[model samples]
Target: MRLHFHPLSPYSRKAMVAVRLRGDAVELQEVDPFSRGLRTAEFVALSPYGKMPVLETSEGPICESTSIIEYLEEQGPAVMLPPGRQRLARHWDRLADLYLMAPMAELFWRRDTPLGLKAPAVCRKTWGLLAQQLADRDFVCGDAFSLGDLSAAIASDYLVRLGLEPPAPVAAWLQRCLAVPAMAWTVELAEGHVQRFLKPLSAEFLADS
Candidate 1:
C-alpha cells in the first residue's frame, strides 16, 4: 500500500497517524496539493476527486481520510476504530472534520478576510463541546486514543498557531493526544511545512508593521 499525502494537511495527518498506529507497512508518498500535485493524471486516476491522503491498496485506491482509516481498521488490529467505541469514534471524527478542521482551514488560508475572521468563532464553538466531552476523559472516546481524538487534536494544533487556543480541558487533552508517538511525529512534520508556508506571510506582515 502507498499513502499519498501532504504533511500540512490535517486530514492527511489523521490518515497517516492511523496507518502508523495500525502498524501498516504502507509506503508514504508526499504530494504537494498546493502545486497541483493531486491533479496529475496518475494521482487523479487513484482519486477522482483529487484529494490528498489517498491509500493505494491491493484491493484498490481509497479516497477520503476517514474512508482510508476505516479501510485500514479492517486490515489491521482495529486500534483506530476499536470494537465497542466505533460509533463514538466515528461521531467525533465527523464533528472534528466538519466543525474544527473545516473552519480552521478556511481561517488558515483567508485569515485577512471577514469570513476568515469568523472562522475562529466557529472553531471555538466546537471546542466548547470538545472541552465538555474531554473534561473527565483522556481522549474524546475515553482512556484509549481512537479516531475520535485524531482529527480534533490535529486541527487544534494548527488552530493554536492561528490564535485560536483550545480551552483548558481541551488544551490538556490535546497534549495527551500529541504524546502518542505517531501523533507527535506527524505534528512535527506538519510544523516544518507550516512554517515554510507561513514564513513569507510573516515577512509581509513585519514589513507592513
Candidate 2:
C-alpha cells in the first residue's frame, strides 16, 4: 500500500498517524498537485478532486483522510482509533477540520479571497468554541488517545500559528497531545513544509522535552 500525500497537510498527517500508530508501514509518496505548475491529469486520476493523502491499496484507491482511516479500521483492528466511541471521535475530527483547518487554509493559502480578511475573526471564534468544548478533557474523546486527538493536535499547531494564545484548558490538551511521540514525528514531517510555504517554524512544539 502507498499513501500519496502532501507532507504538511493536516488531513494527511491524521491518516499518517493512524498508519504509524498501528505498527504498520506503508509506502509514502509526496506530491503537490495543487500547485499550478505541477498539476497533472495522472494526479487527477489518482484523486478525482486532485487532493493529497489518497491511499493506494491492493483493492483500489481510497480517497479522503477519514475514509482511509475507516478503511484501515475495517481491514484490521490495529487501527489507531479506539475500539468504541466512533461517533464522538468522528465528531471531533470533523470539528477540527471545519473550524480550525478551514480558516487556517484560507489565511495561509487563499489570502486574496474575500474570506481571507475575516479569517482571524473566524479562527478566534473557533478557538473559543473548541477551548470550551475541550475544557474538561485531556483528549478530544475523553482520557484515551484516539484518531480524534491526532487530527486535533495538528489543528492545535495551526491555532498556535494563528497567534491567539490557546486558552488554559486547550493549552493543557495541546501539551498532552504534543507529548505523544507520534505527534512529534508528524510535526517534524510537517515543519519544513510549513516553513517553506508559510512562516518560519518554531521548535516550541517539542513539548515533551
Candidate 3:
C-alpha cells in the first residue's frame, strides 16, 4: 500500500496520522498539488476529484481523508475508532472537519473576502464547543487519543500560524493532542510545508490585518 499526500494539507495530515497510529507499513508518496500534480491523468485515475491524500491499496484507491482512515481501520488494528467510543470519535471528527477545518481553509484562501473575514469567528465558536467537550476528558472522545483529535489539532496548528490561536481550554487540549508522538510527527511535517507556503504571503496577510 502507498499513500499519496501533500504535507501542507490538513486532510492529508489526518490520513497520515491514522496510518502511523495504526502502525501501518504503507509507503508514502509526496505529491505537489500546487504544481498541478493532481491534475495529471495518472493521478486523476486514482482520485477522480483530484484530491490529496489518496491511499492506494491492494483492492483499489481510497479518496477523501475520512474515507482513507476508515479503510485503514478495516485493514489493521482499530486504534483510531476504538471499541465503545466509535460514535463519539466519529461525531467530533465530523465537527472538526466541518466547523474547524472548513472555516480555516476559507480563512487561508479568502481572507480578504467577507466569508473569509467571518471564518475566525466561526472557528472561535467551534473552539468553545470543543473546549466544553474537553472539560471532563483529555481527548475528544475520552482519555485516549482517537480520530477526533487528528483533524482538530491540525486545523488549530494552522489557525495559530494565521495568528488566530484557540482560547485557553481548547489551546491546552491542542497541546495535549500534539504531545502524542504520531500527532507531533505529522504536525512537524506540516509546519515545514506551511512556512514555505505562507512565506510569500506574509506581507499580504499582515497588510490585510
Candidate 4:
C-alpha cells in the first residue's frame, strides 16, 4: 500500500504515525498539496476530495486521514488506540481537524497577510480547550496512548511554532508523546516544512492567479 502525504499535514502525520506504529509495510508517497496536480482527474480518481494521506490499498484507495488511519488499524494488533476509548479518540480527532487544520490552511493564502495573523489567537483558544481536557490525564484520553494522543500531538505543533505554551499538563503530555520513536520521526520530518515546502504555495498561487 502507498500512503500519499506531506509531512507537514497534521492529518497526514496522524496517519503516518499509525502506519509506522503498526509496523505496516506501506510506502510513503509525497504529494504536494499546493500543486494543481491534485485536481487532475487521475489523482481525483483515487481520492474524490483530492487530499493528502490517501491510502492506495489492494482493496482500493481510502480517502481522508481519519479513514486511512482506521484502515491501517485493521491491518495489525490495533495498539494505536485502547479498547473502549474510541469515543474519546474521535473527540480529539474532531478537535484537531476542526480547529488546527483550518488555520494551517490559512497559511496558504494568509502566510503573510493580515488574515493569517488572526489565526494564532483563534488556534490558541482551541489549544486551551484541549489543555483543559488533558489536565488530569497523561494522554488525551487517559494513562494509555490512543488516537487522541496522536491528534493532539499533531495539532499542538501550531502552538509550538508560535512559541505559545499550553497548560502545564498539556505541555508535559506533548513532550511525552514526542518522545515516542515514531512520533519523533514524524516531527523531524515535519520540521521546516511550513517555511520551506508549504509557504511557497502562497507565491505559486498568487503567480497563477
lDDT of 4 by residue, 110-184 (tens): 655665566566666777887888778788778876788787677676556544456666778888988888899
TM-score of candidate 4 on Cα atoms, chains taken together: 0.82
lDDT for model 1 comes to 0.85
Question: What would the TM-score be for candidate 3 when compared with the true structure?
Answer: 0.92
Q: After superposition, how far is residue 200 of candidate 2 from its true place, in Å?
A: 7.9
Query: Is 1 or 4 the stronger prediction by lDDT?
Result: 1
Worst 10 contiguous positions by lDDT, candidate 2: 200-209
Look at candidate 3 and tell me the lDDT of residue 110: 71
Model 4, residue 67: distance off in Å is 0.7
For residues 65-158, write the lDDT of model 3, one tens digit per residue: 9989989888768899988988888998998899889988987777768767677777888899998998998888888999978788889888
Among all windows of ten consecutive residues in candidate 4, which has the lowest summed lDDT? 200-209
Q: What is the TM-score of each candidate against the true structure?
A: 0.91, 0.85, 0.92, 0.82
Reference-based lDDT, residue 183, model 4: 91
Model 4 lDDT, residue 99, Cα: 70
| Cα lDDT listed for each candidate | 0.85, 0.74, 0.85, 0.75
lDDT of 1 by residue, 56-94 (tens): 999999999999999888877889987899999999999
Q: Quote the lDDT for 164 in model 1.
A: 60
